[model samples]
Target: MASADDVQRLFLQALVSRRVVTKSLARILLKKCVEAVKAAKEDLDIRIPDNDDSVNTFVINLNASLDKLDLEIVPFVDGLTGNQVYVLANRKGDEVAQVASDYSPAELAYFKVLAEMIITAPNSSYCLSSMAALRETQSLKATFTKTHGERVLDTFVARGWLYKSKSGRYSLTTRSTVELQTYITNTFPNDILHCTVCHEMVFRGIRCYTRNCEGVLHNHCYAAYKRARQTCPVCDTPWNGDSEGKLKKVGEGAFVEGQDKHARARRRVDDEDEDEDETPKQEEAPSRLRHRRRGRGKLRPKGR
Candidate 1:
């Protein structure tokens, strides 16, 4: 049964011990200590009034005043001590203490295990077996079963850290890949098609269609000499059994003499057939009967 004066004395002693007795800081610390005492008294089954609007308002103002005071104090401390100033510094001591007070020992251990799994997982892609193996290596009792693993994975998925592909394989996102690449370069190199003969990047090549003659040539070089002459560049045989003569560029009327003679002969035969088709058929009239009458007169004389 400590009196309020004893409590106030102890609170002032704590502030003096910590060397934090600035006016605004003292007010904020006293308010926090009063709240802590209230919580402790309530733990002893003591009933306090449910409403304390004045205290709540005072706490809100105290927090704002403390923030401004910290902002003013940090620069002075940094300038005097040569310490770097960090803007918006995380003063999470109270938050961490509150969370720690709320968590049981078993719950804290489970949370640690969950955090370790998240950190050690490859690209944060994991399974029950992997977490079990990790725990076994650390000599910790694994409290997670397959269902628990599924729940952990589901949480990561909901947070967009993990994804399941159509093939049922779990994978990390592109953002994760960029983060992991900082540790090591993970890429494979490859080569494009290069001509074996010329040792150049083969943009286009001519393949010999002849069996057992796997000849490849650059398009420009093959056309300039070997192809323009209408010969197999490798074998020197006339392509399509045509004479070893230069091929006329397409749209150029440069037929060979032999080809022209054969074409002209064909055209002459066609013209003769057309003439015969155009000729009309002639009809002969019957000979007059004068010869027959002379024969009849001579026969009449013989009869007389």
Candidate 2:
């Protein structure tokens, strides 16, 4: 049997290499690590059991060691898919500290600007069209060119910081939401929106139609919310739009797709694609701590 420490080290290595992984993937990866350790060490002390509780125990011990290094494994329910994910987070430091060492100053600056734009997007789209994002470099004082912008976005998507949808829109991935949660909340306290059902920060989701009520709900949560009642949970206003919350797009009547099987499948595939790069060679720049002063228009849902 492998020692508990050995199992923990093996599991931590896998997590650090991937940076982010689904809970299901973590379970499978952990099983492999334990088996490898058992094959290598014959007389190790401490027998680690193969069970769900064992994973919790491993995380507790690993976090104790990670504390001294200002790093810890964080688990959060993905807002889009509702599947839990784990991320290696930097505690009490810049959210992008780990990746900052590899990127240049201009790259970092462009990332900061782009991130703010996505977060503050009108109607809480929480996404930017690929074309708009590519052209963003022209507005920056930094020496980032359009080609650099393309590469940076692609790299960030590959690294699990961003997700590129089928429509070529870019939005923050669950990894970014978990890692940047504190930063986003603090920097955009008033601008940030939360789901009325789960009460957690929501980037893309449904919204209620009451004129002054700022009620929003994740697509997954909205389904259950609809089954329970046909009114706004916050203001008790009668639900006006379809269950999908098809609000008017910023420039058109485009509707963001709900969390369907296709969306979940795409997210799973994105995670699998990250397997090629065990360790991220480059990452986004440091997130600026200051609040962005910008105007945002409210999204008005069309009545059915």
Candidate 3:
């Protein structure tokens, strides 16, 4: 464990040695790096986190380190989103760039508005109907037509910003969710707060449509609740089942290479979880086989 700490501790060191350190967790870890730097106080050459034990622990891609002139890393916590986002800030303390320089003004505006609408909409986490997104997008401005909005949304899905279902429902990818979290939380505080049914931060949920019921419940949780109680678990309001069949699941298409980066990342995290389970199962499988072989050997002796 201590040897592992040597590598992880170096990763902690590299993060702080940058322009600036942000995020509470990162800030706490920065102290260790500051101490290390002060002790060394000679030369520091940033290398990949997996280089060696003295500087190795977790693997951080060396390519991710961008070369920007006179820039510093700033940890930004937007007070609303519970996550920290790092930005390369200049002397003025403003973000150096908004990511790729190729995005047109129209594209940037369209992306933000669409992200806000999808994440802030009621029943968002369960899945916002694509039709609903179009309606909201059209309302962004007089000139923004539903057709244009649809194209923008399609572009977002293709670029891995959102997940589009075959049946035309949309869900936020982890990228969009993290980026637009502050907007979603601030815009729809009541909806995004603890689910009324389970008191959890599950915004992809359905609402109690019973005339001012205002109760929000997770889709799966509501499924069980509706089966047993036929009423809102948060409030005693009668449940309004999916009268319009909007909750029906639409099978999503398989992901392909060079598309849906967020999907790829999500699948990776899920794969990691499965791999953890497989390790124990693999050991158990071999042990079972060995036990069976021993039993056969005993049977052979009895035959003799």
Best by TM-score: 2
lDDT of 2 at 43: 61
lDDT of prediction 1: 0.34
List the candidates' TM-scores in order: 0.19, 0.74, 0.37
**Residue 47 of model 1: what lDDT?**
26
| Error of model 2, residue 42, in angstroms | 3.6
lDDT of 3 by residue, 1-304 (tens): 1332343446434553432234444434534654554456434443322223322122223113422433334334322233444433332212233442244455565555445444434323335566556755543444677777777677677654667766676766543444444445554454354556556455344665555555665555565567678666555655555642333221122122223334234434543554453334445676443323221110000000
Q: What is candidate 1's lDDT per residue for 1-304, written digit by digit as tens?
A: 5333333444434543442133344445556666666665544432222334443343344346456433111211111112222112222223343353333433334433433232223311221233332232232244545555555545444533334444333333222222222221211001112333453322233445455553444444454455456656555556545442332211011112233234234434543544453333344222322211111110000000
Looking at candidate 2, what is the lDDT of residue 27? 76
lDDT per model, in order? 0.34, 0.65, 0.44
Alpha carbon lDDT at 180, candidate 2: 70
Compared with the true structure, what per-residue lDDT tens digits does model 2 show for residues 137-230? Answer: 7766667788888988777787777788888888777777776777677666776788877888888677765577778887677767788788
lDDT value, candidate 2, whole model: 0.65
